[model samples]
Target: MDSNKAKNLEQILESSIKDPKDLTRYLYYRKKLKEEGLSDFISILPLGAAINWARANSVWPLTFGIACCAIEMMAVGASKFDLDRFGSGVFRATPRQTDLMIVAGTVTYKLAPRIKKLYEQMPSPKYVIAMGACASSGGPYTQLGYQVIKGVDKIIPVDVYIPGCPPRPEALIDAVLLLQDKISKTIPQQEAI
Candidate 1:
């Protein structure tokens, strides 16, 4: 199929498959097509933009809370705020399964290396969100605590920085939304060619 036809088909499928189960079936079929040695078929499909859109919408965050801000992060996942609406509610236990790492508290000098290790373990196109002043720039500990790392960005790249001693849950939601926007804007390398 031509790229335009593929794009149209993708749009139709997206519009038709609102249920999660239907989406899963669609993904299965796509995987099957790829496994059948259909490189040309896959290349012509608008899989680049479609895959990025899927990644942006369904960002599975790593469950790695650090401090007080971690509580606020949890609140976002709770009933009142309902982060599931944004498609980022599912928190994965392992770095391998998670695409987003929300560093929701302080990063000390000792923990910096471990954090970097976790970041390295994550797959490509992973994102880091510095979700508090402490994670962003060591909050109250910058001057007082000699052992605290100044910023998480120093250890691994941070995509979004939400500032507060312990930012509100709403701020965490906003940060996730911002990260989604950023991810959606990314052009897959294949599309660049």
Candidate 2:
């Protein structure tokens, strides 16, 4: 089946339904196909479905804020920047639950290992955005603060770094848009990197 046929998210939602509020017709089709030992044909659904689903639902983020920049991160999710417009407004609390980790504030030495652990917990295809100067190069803290790490990137490979003491919400939105653009260009490999 052509992916163009699945462009209507509503139709995809309709076909994917299951049970009481569910897909009686779909289940019937599945059962008939199964009993006939034609499950090989059914395998294509997951492939097509996964591609469709990822385009729509990819980039769940871990919002780890340690300082002023966190507010900018919050503003991106609010009415103005509206991070939801790109499906990344959901601020995931746990690293295990998100793939896009936006380090919006200062990352101190004490927090470096925690950040590393969280990065490890995030599933494959993960990305890290070092937001604000505090998170990027430790901002003004780099001059005076001995405790602050020079940047989150000192400990993690940063995908995008928004440079500002606390970057504006618009900057965060731009960073996310860049991330989206990158995601769109990505192709799957035979094996995970």
Candidate 3:
């Protein structure tokens, strides 16, 4: 069979069978072997389960706030919104101590380097959340502003953008939840080869 057919057959055997039409020549044989009790399916189950768990609850965030929107970010960190519900309440000031950088205000030209440096300081598996329109895309200052850097994403890789002039605390919570969803979709990091 061609490489494409082989790849499809492998996918059929590994994932849901979908239908008889979904199975290619190789998977048809594998199904017959399973009916005859030839091979075990439990062998790779542990790794698959570990991957699912890793994708669910492993998020850390850095509280990197500047300008006015920084206040809203603080409110999210406070009692009402309780960012801990998303497992990201521990607002680490240093980038080295966090995985997600919550860009919570206007990123000025001078501050852009600091933002980039902090992003670089983070370990592997780092993520960023641009909180507010200012942090996301310059907001009211977008019309030819000299000092404003527009968006935090220009300097650092932003994984989620929470849009608003200055997003409410509830909006910030939603952004955190969105970040959680993104976290859930990421491939789990594997052990070193």
TM-score of each: 0.74, 0.69, 0.71
Order of candidate numbers by TM-score, starting with the best: 1, 3, 2
Tell me how many residue pairs clash in candidate 1. 0
Q: Which candidate comes out best when scored by TM-score?
A: 1
- The lDDT values for all models are 0.84, 0.76, 0.72
Off by over 4 Å in 3: 1-58
Q: In candidate 3, which residue pairs clash?
A: none
lDDT of 1 at 78: 96
Write the number of the candidate with greater TM-score, choosing between 2 and 3.
3
Expressed as tens digits, the lDDT of each residue in 1-193 for candidate 3 is 6999857735633553334554464456656777878657522222333454454455667766787788888887788878777677777767777777788888898887777778788987777888889888888898888899788778877778888888888988887677766654444555621
lDDT of 1 by residue, 1-193 (tens): 6999868756765654457886777777777877898855564324455777788899999999999988888889999999999998899999999899999888998898899999999987799999889989888889999899998999999899998878888888999999987876676665343
Better model by lDDT, 2 or 3?
2
Top candidate, metric lDDT: 1
Clashes of each: 0, 1, 0
Better of 1 and 2 by lDDT: 1
Name the weakest run of 10 consecutive residues (lDDT summed) in model 2: 43-52
